[model samples]
Target: IDPRKTETAEIASAHHFIVPGSDAYLLLAMLQLMFERDWVNAGHLAPLLQGVETVRELVAPFTLALAQERTGISAAVIEAMTEKLVQTPRAVFYGRMGVSVQEYGALCQWAIQLINLLAGNVDVVGGALVPNSAAGYVKPGERGAGHFNRFQSRVSGLPEFGGELPATVMAEEMLTPGEGQIRAMLTLAGNPVLSAPSGQQLDQAFEGLDFMVSMDIYINETTRHADYILPPTSALEHDHYDFAFHRLAVRNTARYNEPVFEPEAGALHDWEILNQLSQKLGDHKGIDVKMFPAPSAIVDQSLQQGPYGKHNQRGDDALDLAALREHPHGIDLGPLTPSLPQRLCNEEKNIRLVWQGIADDIERLRIASPPQQQGKLLLIGRRHVRSNNSWMHNSHRLVKGKPRWRCLMNSKDMHEHKLADGDDIVISSRAGEVQTEVEQSDDVMPGVVCLPHGWG
Candidate 1:
């Protein structure tokens, strides 16, 4: 269910128009009803799950009546949805930016996963399945024990995750004075100016940088500020293989794409540019600058040693990279299989459902309240199929026919404010304000406005 009458929502069994930023409460209430009705998958969950009692106690305060008031979703609807979740043999709760961009985002995400696990849906067919890739990437060790934080950000003191600080602090690090201040930055395929939280703040921060280098395909809003803009070869000119997407695919599949066209003279692939830059910087201890120089060689080696490799001496069921090369279309591996706690559990083969991080955050969620709208419309972002991002706005084919950038306000709201279609309206938030043409539509929920993201 979603707040907006989006294209996806039109075909949904039911569309719930929830109050913005109240996802956590709604989800918690669902879990509460599940527990109260005794509809959980006890047998499957009893063996692999932990912290059930804790979660049950944590969500006790979030009754259906309270949830109805907070989420603007009727108690009957909440109960019906919760009943559907429990009655279904295999179900998964999937949420995107609607749940992520609000307060208690992390809590809502954790709660969704918890609900799926309690329902015996995780790592199973027709449920929340895990992808099995040929590449056996080593899983990072446990946090706070094997992977400890070395330092905190100077400005916000936010602890680093996976040896990297949050991108939201980039502007502060550049503008702040003191030791270890960031004076220069090297960005790769990132448009933080448009994608980041505050575009105005990031624009000022980019202006303040001593030196900046950007590796991008287009001279867009973010790259225009860079002292040196290194454009990489287009996707059509680069040999492509799926690395990250394969690991997240719903079904098992493998595909390789040879360059469709040769790159222009003197143009370098993204990998080559980074390799050459590393050599120039005098760091060549472990890397072989000469060996496996091109992406094709790297792909061959990775596939040869990967799970589908014919050269894999470990098993007879191994696959051959040559077979894949012959089939230029693609190779379908098949549907998701059940690879449960054994394939994904910790070193001791145990799933720790309750963590210190989640436990501490529950207290915060207990007292959490939605931000006061104060008679102002809550602003949210939307995406169009034609526009990939701000960069795609330059494409004549994509931006042709009609304008796609406009503030979408509910018809009731527009009529109440004495505004007409195509009238310019000023939208102001604590971060900043922008004046844009208004489009009156019932697709958006009342007291909320929708604006497409990545627009300059």
Candidate 2:
């Protein structure tokens, strides 16, 4: 975790790709090397692999020079990182809050997956093991023509996750005049305006929405715009199970925490609210809907339809919540099952890296109108340990030591602009502009700026 630590016994070599804002480009560069050098073990990938040639072709344009330019990373540094991966033991590459919220967020995520796959580090010891939790291994929802393979938003047709796009377009969907424009929004555990793209634009868009509903624990920026705010119980009030991270950890470990206190006031559990809203929306309120059903039902349903469904043909009914809870924390799922040869999505056993449609989208952006050359600063979002999204923003202890939000600038860049640290500055992006106090930090490279989320 320390940047100062040299590549060592536990670590081999560490290289930082100054590819500040975009994680996808950095990943492409690494994948390009794996293909070009034949470092990937083809045999290791069995029936669960799909679309290898497509991936290779997609990454072809992201040569060292191109990536360096696109990501602001030095080619030499990228190459050095590749070298370290080739020489290190248990060398694991990771990225967290940094790449998850960006203009090209999904691409960044995909690229990280590609790097892990090519390096043969997935689900392996000291590698990028899928973290599992006591929530049980229930797969995500199904992917279909209406789902995966298609983009829905007007400006950016980002691929859908769980039958929906990035949720970045929620505000816009309601504002843009159209027949299919969103008339209602149901946000479950998300704050789009603070976490999504085009913050200024989104703010304007929210004002135009007919009905905005928020299911959250606390009232914050985005929720303040809602017509109805449904409060959900805080983490301490509910049983905790991290279903997503369990599959990604090196060693399977599970921890269970019983509710610290009984539900007080009118605060309802998150799952209960989600179920209530879904039934009301689906117009089937009379029938009971188990939002978070038994793990077996979830696993069976997901395996039968989700992206991983086809791969796991003969699933057992034994995998359920009772089974998971039997061990209290969780049962270690062990190493990742094989994936290369068999296609997880396609019937054929191959890897489809290109995702032609995604490639086309990026290509369009490349050729699209360039960002305005105005002096506005590029806006970026950062996360903190205090809360997720805008749920607990009012916590006095959390916001007391820091500005609710910050405008981070490279010291050199600040000096060049003749702007002093702590001075209020107007930041303008193609989306719009906002005023925030500036803070100088050497952590960010010159010419770039960062802003913490949860502040207007």
Candidate 3:
């Protein structure tokens, strides 16, 4: 479900128009119905689950009626969908940007997992399968394998995730005074000024930094303020492995690639630049650059130690970097299978159905009324294939299409506001305003408007 009639929605068997920020309510209501109808079923995973009863109690107030009121989706529709979920075999409920980037993002994620669990689908055939990814297969009970809250941002006390503060907090961390203040920055392959929350604020925050270095190909919106720009070899000039994204693939697969084109003389790879900088900064202030391992070596080691690797007793069938390299396309590691209790990172080898933070967040949603939509259009972001990446602005071949950066207003909304297609208009919010040409499209929900996300 999405505010706009996306292409995916067009091809979908069913599509529901959901208010931009109210998906958590729908999730909560679905859980409530599942509990009420006694449809809660985790199958074999029941033994590993905890706090089902507590979740039931917390979600009681977020009934179908309440969810309908909040999400702009009808009560009957929500109820029917909930029933369908229970009746369907091996059903899975997944959400993306709409579920996240909302007030209850973390809560929504927890609820989605809960829905899959209660549907008796976790780690089962035809259901969600936890694959032993060759690129990133962490063993069960591995220390620090999904740990959280070890520390927080020094300025706003925002909890850190994987030892990194949220991008939303970066501006505040730099602007805030006193201890642990940010005086320098080293940006790499990111454009926080245009992409991050409170982006305009980051513009000011960046100007105040004592020293700023950017390791990027383009002096785009974020990197323009850098005192020094380090241009590294492009992806075309670098050997790559899908080390990060392969873990997220639906099926287990391994692919290794060699650079099709060699780098020009006097050019440096990103790792080489970083290594040299590390050496210049001294041992105490930087990583041991002299002993730094190349990315290929790391990938080789990971493959060697992996399940399908040389270390495995599986003989000739074992996989390694060399074996992966043999297949220029990719090696299919086979379909996803039930790797459950072993797939879990915790020593408990169980899925806790509850978290105190989520419970409290649900309470807030229960008491708080949905934000009044009258006289206020919910602004949603969109992206096009041609211009989604700001760095591609310089690519004439990619950006030489119809202009995509325009305000898309629902036809009814345009009529009510006495505006027309191609009319120059100003979109305003509590934070700020932007001027863009408006285009009428009945494809969007009446109270929702959209703007392509790119280059501020």
Off by over 4 Å in 2: 1-26, 33-43, 46-61, 103-107, 130-146, 149-151, 154-159, 200-212, 265-267, 273-354, 358-377, 386-389
Output the number of the lDDT-best candidate.
Answer: 3
The superposed Cα distance between candidate 2 and the true structure at residue 97, in angstroms, equals: 4.5
Clashing pairs in 1: 308-319
334-431: candidate 3 lDDT, tens digit per residue: 99888877677676787887877777888887788668677988898877778774656768898886767888899899999999889888877765
**Global lDDT of each model?**
0.79, 0.61, 0.84
Candidate 1 vs 2: which has more TM-score: 1
Question: Candidate 1: which stretches are off by over 4 Å?
Answer: 42-45, 136-150, 283-293, 311-317
Better candidate by lDDT, 1 or 3 = 3
lDDT of 2 by residue, 384-439 (tens): 45644555666776656756566778777888899897899887655677789998
lDDT (0-100) at residue 362 of candidate 2?
A: 57
Candidate 2, poorest ten consecutive residues by summed lDDT:
1-10
